[model samples]
Target chain A: MELTLGPLAYHWPADIRRDFYARIADEAPVGTVYLGEVICSKRAPFHEPDLPATIERLERGGKRVVLSSLAEVMLKREREATAGLMAAEDHEVEVNNAAGLMDRGRRPHRIGPFLNAYNEATIAWMAGQGATHVCLPAELPGHSAAVAARAARALGVGVEVQVFGRAPLAVSARCYHARAHGRHKDNCQFVCEDDPDGMPLLTLDGKPLLRVNGIQTQSESYVELVEALPELAAAGVSHARLLPQAVDMVAVARVFADHLGGMCDATEARARLAGICAGVSFSNGFFHGVAGYRHIARLGTAH
Target chain B: MTGAEDFSAAGELVCPAGTPAALRTAVEAGADTVYCGLRNATNARNFPGLNFTPEELQASVAFAHARGAKVLLAVNTYPPAGQLALWHEAAAIGMRAGVDAFIVADMGVARHIAETWPRARLHLSVQAAASSPEAIRYYCTHFGVRRVVLPRILTIPEIRAIRREIPCEIETFVFGNHGLMVEGRCSLTNWLTGQSTNLDGVCSPAAEVTFERADDGTMRSCLSGFTIDRFAAGETAGYPTICKGRYAAPHRPEGYYAFEEPVSLNLGRLLPELMAAGVHAFKIEGRQRSKSYVRQVVGAFRRAVDSIRSGHDPDLADLVALTEGQKETQGAFQTKKWR
Candidate 1:
């Protein structure tokens, strides 16, 4: 399976954003790079000027670049931005919401994980609409992903699954990050910038439960599926997406690449990942068809 | 703004029907329309011991139509991989049963209905999360949707602004379980319990839930072995859905409702404002509630609509007792303070 770099779900300063992409383009062993914002529209302007240079640099480095649409399109400006992306000339557009579908028409595009393609019929229908690739939602178990991947392969569409980073648990029109910081979504004042990753939210029992970004809520535990690569490959998945995180992403990509290429074993790569994953725990329970917070390893047997 | 003359006509009163008895009760209680689903993952309220069978759906549709009331079939949940045929079969069965409209959420399912049954009237489910006019228009234009049930996150002014922009009709929740999370976008319960509200129509599946009393004489509601909420000695413990549970945040060391408090949504006081905002239908959201809940809520809303039509205010005090925590709020309708 090939490694694909998913979009940045958080807000970083323009310099950080640019430098992060530059390092990925130069050092990361990722084949496809998805650029642009997928969370809040208010944070787009901070990185819009750097987008062209970053996209050009990635393309110049022999990486396939795709522009991602917003996961939640509520405002008129968001809709217009989607339309503009659909009408763009250079890169493939990943449609995240229904508005993107309206603007895309029959053009070749990619369907993001946020669009809710749960079944084979949905994927086939999207394929009919000229979608060349489909990213399944992060909550799907291994069996469900296998079924979807089989259907997608039959229809000549590539199936991509999220193999790393925190699974996006929810998205809302209201900004929980701003609300936690004592402000409304309308006047969030870019407070989400304060948390480079996301603001951690704890349960009543002092257990870490979730992270609140601008309008998006994510799982507190980062999801890791390195050991599940055999099952994923056997299930007909073509690409494994690694979401950008606040760590040595280049090393992250290299480990996944080495593991996929048979250069390193699962245990060695996992030990290396554990060093950089920080104090946060790694979970693969959703892939095992159980609670997402639990990490169940099925090493010797099929799930 | 909608003038008094136009607002006096009163919007349609849509009620929920989880069981056959609830369906008949809602129709008999003056609900202009009653929505229901088949006993499977085809609908959003796919709880055990609830919903109608195919035979029951046909009978219920006939019962409602014979009384001049409409029956809308809810095929709203997103179908899982290799399981789209179940949703398709449900819609086909609903059409054969002569249902009035199909409430669909997934874009693929909507497209299938639009292509297969071009004459079928379609209503965008709240699970589709079409909060903006552009998103509503996309569904209306692409799938021939006739109406859209707006998500619970918008304010009254926001709904009015959306009404002015979109072509299809608009529906809003009048009362019921307050889903503080964004409709169709939340997966907190699925992350805890294997059952998914998006794919399986269940949030906090009862099969995985256990309420236990602690040694300190307090109550703890656990879902899949995770402590969702801890109730004090006398505090009532409602269903633990993860979102409404009290949680400790960064600065606030003590447990607080970081997301939302356990309260139901009651928009009875804002009936006039909702109608003036150009809402086409008022939906009461308790399909899994009791038959008495269906009767009382449908009857109260019917009376409230009629009272407004007669140019008078409504008396809806009895409905407050039906709330989850015996407390209610307008819930993002009158103000945006909910966040």
Candidate 2:
């Protein structure tokens, strides 16, 4: 399966974003890189000035780039931004919102995970809408993902699954990142950038349960599917997505690529990944059809 | 103002009904339209003891039609892969029941209804989360959607701008739970529990809810073995929905409502503003509520809509007793500052 990098869901400094993409372009093993602001429109302009150069650099490095739309499109400017992204003729667009789907019309596009293509019939219908690829929601279980992937493959449309990084759980109209700092969404000055990986949200008992990134809520544990890669490939999944987190992504990419390329076993790859993202919890329970926060050990594997 | 033309210019008052009895109550209480779902995972409110059977739906439709009220079937949940049969069966039953419209979320279900019954009126369910005019127009142009129940994230001005761009009717929520998260996109409950509002058609299912009293005399609301919130003794505790529960962070160790407070949304004061914004229908959410709750809320809105149409300010009913946490806010309807 080909490795793909999902759009960054957090806000970072313009130079930081540029440097991050440059490394991914030159060193990371990901085949397709999704670039754009998928979380907040306010963060779009900060990185948009570097987009053309970044895309050019990535393409020059033999990486295919796809532009992604915002997950929430409520404001007029957000609508216009989505329309602008849909109008791009240089690269394939991955639509995360319905507005992008409408603006893209019958043009071939990718369905981002934010869009609810949960079932086979939904995949079939999206394929009818000229969708060339689809990334299933992170909450979907393995069996259901297999069904959706097979269905999309039958229609000659590629299917993608998130195999790494935090799972995006929800998006709210209110910005919790701002609200947490005692500010309104409109007046709050880019406070989400304080937490490059997202601010941790704990339960009343002080257990880290979720993370807040602007208006989006994400899983506290990174979703690690190193053990499920074979299952995904057997299920006809075309791409394995690795969400960009604040970590050594190039090394993270190498770990997955080595495993997929028969250079290492799942056990070795997982151990190396553990060293790469030390002190961070990893979860595959959502793929196991259980609570997303739980890290269910595979049968016969030592914990 | 004459009889039929009195509230003709005003938007349709759509009310919710969880049972056949509630359906009758909403219709008699002055609802122009009543929406309900079947007792299955096909609908978002797939709660036990709520929703209708095929027989109940047919009888309810007849009762509502006799009272000059329309009946709508909400098959709003996304059908899971290999489980499309249940949703399709529900849609077929809804059509057989002679409901006026089908409120749908998934594109596959919309395509099914449009293909099976070419003339069936389709209203885009809020579960679709189609907030932009382009999204609404896509549904209208593709599946002949007559109306779109917009997501609650849009402000009044945004709605007005959207109405000018879309070629369909608009529906906005006027009362009930404060759904701060975007519908169909939230998986907090699904992450905590196994069921979800999008696929399983349930959020924080009642079976998984538990209330325990700590030795310190705190009332703790738990869902799926996780403590969602803790309330002091004598304090009112809301349902253990993940979003409404309080949480802690390093910056605020005292705990805060990270997503939203336990307050409910009451747009009773914004009737005139919504009408001016070109909203064609006002929807009252709460299919899991009791018949009495349905009656009181629907009746209040009914009178309020009529009062506005007659060039008089609405003497809005005191619905504090029916609201969650006994508090209400205009939410995103009044201003963007609510964000």
Candidate 3:
């Protein structure tokens, strides 16, 4: 099993963003890399100029680079931007929502986690559409991913899993943050940047429920599949995607890579991960049909 | 010499059938069309204890057609990646069972229908989020789209503008639960877990939802194991969906409707105005409702539309108890009070 560093979903500046990828390029131990702006279309221009150097550095470090696309697809401007990204003759592209690519007739691309790939037909269809690797949606339970992995193997498409970071749950045209602040989407003036990770929303009783980005809302807890490494490998998951977070990403990558290589067990990895993470919690509920938040192991709850 | 069959409008009273009995009730209540789906992602209303199987759908179609009603099978959810076959087979089966139309979303699924049934009368599902006339017109121009159920985000005037632009007929939601979703794409359900109302055609799967008693004498309704809101005794609590419930946001410290309240949309009073705006059909919004709800909502809407056509005022107060939140709004039709 190998580790794949997925695209950063937040709106970090050019210096920080460049320096972050620079660290991954020089020192971080990961096999595959997905580099591009996967968030707002406006944010792409800031990172596009520096992408070539980042790609060159990562490629020199023996990593395969895949270009990422937007998550929420609607505006024609966003569509045109994605079209240009997909039309890049340089690197393989990962289709996020499968919007324009649906009728592109014949095009080679990687299907990202946001794209819906649930069963054999979708798997076969993606392979037929030229998907070399398909990252299953983060919401897909572990078993579903396993089943889809088997199907991918038959279709000659590889499967990837999201092992770390806050999983992006949904994207919308309406910016909840802007709407909350009584500002229109066009002139909202970069409010989402306050929470580099995302703004956590609590319930009426003060329990953390969800995190709100620009137009995206995610689980307040970062979903850590550190314990599911053996299970994921057994499920035929070849690549583990480590989503970027505002933490010790290098250390996080080291832990995930070590776990994937079978150097450490699930118990050791969980204990190490606990020390590095911030105030937020972690969950793996999508795997079971139980609550999205129900932890397999809790500190206070007696077994 | 004008007859009902020869009416230029051919205005169909599209109704919802949550149960097998409601299927019969809708047909008997002069509903021209009845729409439903299986209890899975095959339909948007993936509520528990509702929907039908292949045999049930076939039987429902026969029952409707035998009584001069048409069955429009709704296979509307965006088929999750690699799961297009479930939706594809649903379309094939709907056609084989003599369904009048196939309501659909997901460009991939739409492409499948276009390739398979070149002549099938396809109706774009509101879940497709085809809010603009240009978007609707694109579907009509590309696929063999015949009609579209406009999302609840548009005003009546906007609907009128869209009706003028698109070549296909337009269906507007008249009554029942109003989904505040931004149409074809909503991932709030999946954010909590991987299961969603969009992919597998469920919103908050019944199995994931649990009502718990809080220590402060309140009840919490959770979807995918997250608490959205809690209510005191006698305070009505609706089914929990992440996007809908009360929550504390960054700016708003006092907990309130973070996204939208689970209010039902009742547009019965605006039937005359909408028909005048060139809408061809009025859709009732409850497929998970009971047979009695089907009878009550469809019957009241039927009376209201007929009353408008006869140049008389229609009384829709009888539909108060059937709405999801026990309250109703005009949605985005009358004003900017939309979710």
| Alpha-carbon deviation at A231 in model 3, angstroms | 3.8
Question: All models: lDDT?
Answer: 0.86, 0.90, 0.74
Instruction: Flag the better candidate by lDDT, 1 or 3.
Output: 1
**In each prediction, how many residue pairs overlap at the backbone (N, C-alpha, C within less than 3 A)?**
0, 0, 14
Q: Which runs of model 3 end up more than 4 angstroms from their true locations?
A: A42-62, A297-303, B1-13, B28-30, B39-41, B53-56, B76-96, B104-175, B182-200, B205-226, B232-234, B266-282, B299-339
Q: What is the TM-score of each candidate against the true structure?
A: 0.94, 0.97, 0.81
Highest TM-score among the candidates is held by which one?
2
TM-score: the better of candidates 2 and 3? 2
What fraction of the native interface does candidate 1 get right in terms of contacts?
0.59
Candidate 1 local Cα displacement, residue B209, angstroms: 2.1
Q: Whose TM-score is higher: candidate 1's or candidate 2's?
A: 2
Q: Runs in model 2 with CA error above 4 Å? A: A300-303, B1-9, B317-325
Model 3 CAPRI rating: acceptable
Model 3 chain B: worst 10 consecutive residues (lDDT sum): B1-10
Per-residue error at B237 for model 2, in Å? 2.1
Lowest summed lDDT window (length 10), candidate 2 chain B: B1-10
lDDT of 2 by residue, B7-67 (tens): 2244799999999999999999999999999999999999999999999999999999888
Order the candidates by DockQ, highest first — what do you get?
Answer: 2, 1, 3
Candidate 1 structure quality by residue, lDDT tens digits, B1-339? 001112113479989998989999999999988999999988999999999988999999889879988888999999888678899999899988988899999988999988988888899999998877767888888788888999998889888999998998888998989887778887888888777889889888899889889889899888887778899988788888787777666776677766667788999888889999999899999899998878878888888888888888776665555564477888788777664
For residues B9-54, write the lDDT of model 3, one tens digit per residue: 5346899887777889998887878988876678888777888888
